[model samples]
Target chain A: MKYTEEHEWLRIEGDSVVVGITEHAAEQLGDVVFVELPEIEAVVAKGDEVCVIESVKAASDILAPVDGEITEVNEALTDNPGLVNEDPQGDAWFFKMKLDDLSVLDDLMTEDEYKDFLG
Target chain B: MSDTLRRTPLYDLHTELGGKIVPFAGYAMPVQYPMGVMGEHTHTRSHAGLFDVSHMGQVILRGPDAALALERLVPVDVAGLAEGRQRYAMFTNDKGGILDDLMVANRGDHLFLVVNAACKAADIAHMRAHLPELEVREITDRALLALQGPGAEAALNALLPGVADMRFMDVATFDWQGHALWVSRSGYTGEDGYEISVPDAQATAFARALLAQPDVAPIGLGARDSLRLEAGLCLYGHDITEMTSPVMAGLQWAIQKARRAGGAREGGFPGAERILQELADGPLAIRVGLRPEGRAPMREGTVLWDAPEGGRNLGGVTSGGFGPSIGAPIAMGYIPTTSAQPGTRLWGEVRGKRLPVTVCDLPFRPSTYKR
Candidate 1:
């Protein structure tokens, strides 16, 4: 799993990768009341806004970490957005995408590097 | 945190309780605790939430001519406010604009006031400049705390007896642990609550005692704002600005009948002519509650248009966010009087997306104030 400066995490699995917001992002957003997900098979570029997470305070945009086509979105988030706050890294993963460029993963940060970057 | 940002009496307490500190009105205040904004907001509605509102300014008005001096600045019927009661009031400018909204409590011997934190300094200066002959003392040595929700009265009553008996809008001074504490049965969350003014020295211990209760949890500004928005309450600078009039803000109820047309004390305060004229007819624009069409919450400063694509701009959103209690996106903003009617369809342009919205009756949720 790798993390982006925008607070999103990506886990590479073969030609596909799973994505979700970092726990830090979840904490900063307070409570996750609603999550607007991208449609399946939607092409998105690196750093492009793909979804939105609305909390009680404000609405925040979630951006794609790398260029790819969204293969599957977490449908469970539509009904129970609280999963993002409860287990952001696991059950609350936002979407899975088919990787268009594997080299983009090298640009991301590891778990330890993400912690140091936050510090 | 900015070094220049002032800290409240409960600053250390907020930190100890894991509150996320943010700069608000020149003060480092908690925006939410570890429970998060949504949790705190819901806790306040169902149980009780304790808020550290010490950043707000507390003032005391005294002397023989105090009431008359205050009456000259605000349009509310100050003289008519009975002893041991609080009334919502606003300071208006010569142009009929709201200088600031405030709470006026007649404590019998002297009048007590609580003003918004951001406008406190300017409010004190305005009062001192206008009423130089009367006594205006800013009570800086005290901290103000609000305990709000359905369980507020029960939690507070455990600390101080007889608070449950005090009806809504009532104010009185009572002894707590041998210290004199001034309390008012009022709050901004539209819940049955109490605002207690305590000496700064005892603020920490007092707050700790309240938090020890099963029904009480330390809430922060984030939930405080959401709760007020759910209850359709206006924020000071955002919803009700100096450019907005009380009448246009839908605050006509704050203006007493005695201060209106043909009454004994008609047209004495600032902007009297314009306010009275509006009261007779109606303001060109009025603020109303709004419900957006979809999941995307329309934020403040979003332009409201007559049509979905393009048309005449109606007004703008002053306060907009998700209402946890309502379980949907809700908002409040100014619109033309013609469009102010409930069920009027409108469109809000946000980030280039035109979203449908509807004018609705305030309080997206019913007020459970203990009146």
Candidate 2:
């Protein structure tokens, strides 16, 4: 698993990368009440905001970590947004994107690097 | 946190309870504790929640003409207010705009006023400049704390007896550990609770005593806000502002009949011409409760429209968030009188997408005030 400066975690699966916010972001956002995911099969760039997450306090956006096409989105979040707060890194993965170059993941930060960045 | 921000009497206790300190109205106050906003909100609805509202200004108006002098500023009937009773009031500008909303209680010899934190200085100055004959003394030695929710009476009564017997909107003086507490059976959250004015030195101890109760927990500003919104209450800086009139904000109920047209003591207050006219006729725009169809909350400043594509720009949301008690998104905003009816359909633009919203009767939840 890799991390982005925007507090998103990326997990590589075959040619696709699963993306979700880190626990730090979830904790900062308080309880997740609503999630608006990007359309499936939508193309996106690294800096594009692909999702919107609404917590009890405020609304925040989830930016795409790398240039990719959104192949899948977690629909469960629409019915149960609290899942993002409960299992942000696992079952709450927002979307799966198919990237042109999977090697782009190497440029991201490791777990240790993410912790250092947080510090 | 900035060094210039003031700290409340409960600052140490808040830090001890793992409260997330944030800047609010020039004070370093807790937005939420370790329980988080959602838990605190629900807890306050079911149990009792203690809020350190010491940031708000507390003032004592004394002199033989205090009530009459205060009536010159607000639209409410101050002279008609009975002793030991509290009434909601607002300081209106000359143009009928709201300067600040406040709570005024007739405490027999003197009147106690509670104004919003952000509007404290202006409210004080306004009162002093207008009511120069009266004493508008600001009480800095007292800290205001609100104990709200269904279990508030039991928790507060356990420590300070006689609070449970006070009816809603009733004010009384109670003794607690040698401190004279100005207790009022009222609160911002539409709950059966009390707002206690304790001495600054004893504020923390009194709060701790209440927290010791099995039904009491420490709540923060975040929950206080959501709870008030759910109760369909107007936030001073949000739902009502200097640009908004009391009638437009649906606060005409606070204006007493004695202060209206044809009454014995009518039209002596500021903005009386405009306010009385609005009361007799109607406001062009009115504040109404809005509920978004989806789980996504329509926050403040979200624009409203008549159509999803492009129709007419109606108005904007003022106070909005996910109402924990209602289990959905609820909001309050100003819209044209034509579109202000409950059940009227409207659209709020969020992230450039128009989402369906319905104008509903406010308080998404019913109030449980001990009336």
Chain B alone, candidate 1, TM-score of 0.99
- Chain B only, TM-score of each candidate: 0.99, 0.99
- Evaluate model 1: give its lDDT: 0.92
Clash pairs (backbone) in predicted model 1: none
Q: Which of the CAPRI classes, incorrect, acceptable, medium or high, describes model 2?
A: high
Q: How well is candidate 2 docked (DockQ)?
A: 0.95
| Top candidate when judged by TM-score against the true structure | 2
Q: Candidate 1: where is the Cα deviation over 4 Å?
A: A39-41
Judge candidate 1 at residue A41 and give its lDDT: 90
TM-score of 2: 0.99
TM-score of candidate 1 to 2 decimals: 0.97
TM-score of each: 0.97, 0.99
Distance from true position, residue A10, model 2, in Å?
0.7
Which lDDT tens digits does candidate 2 get at residues B1-371?
79999999999999999999999999999999989999999999999999999999999999987898899999999999999999999999999999999999999999999999999999999998998998999999999999999999999998889899999999999999888999999999898999999999999999999999999999999999999999999999889998999999999999998899988788888788999999999999999999999888999999999998889999999999899889999999999998888988999999898999999987788899888
The superposed Cα distance between candidate 1 and the true structure at residue B278, in angstroms, equals 1.0
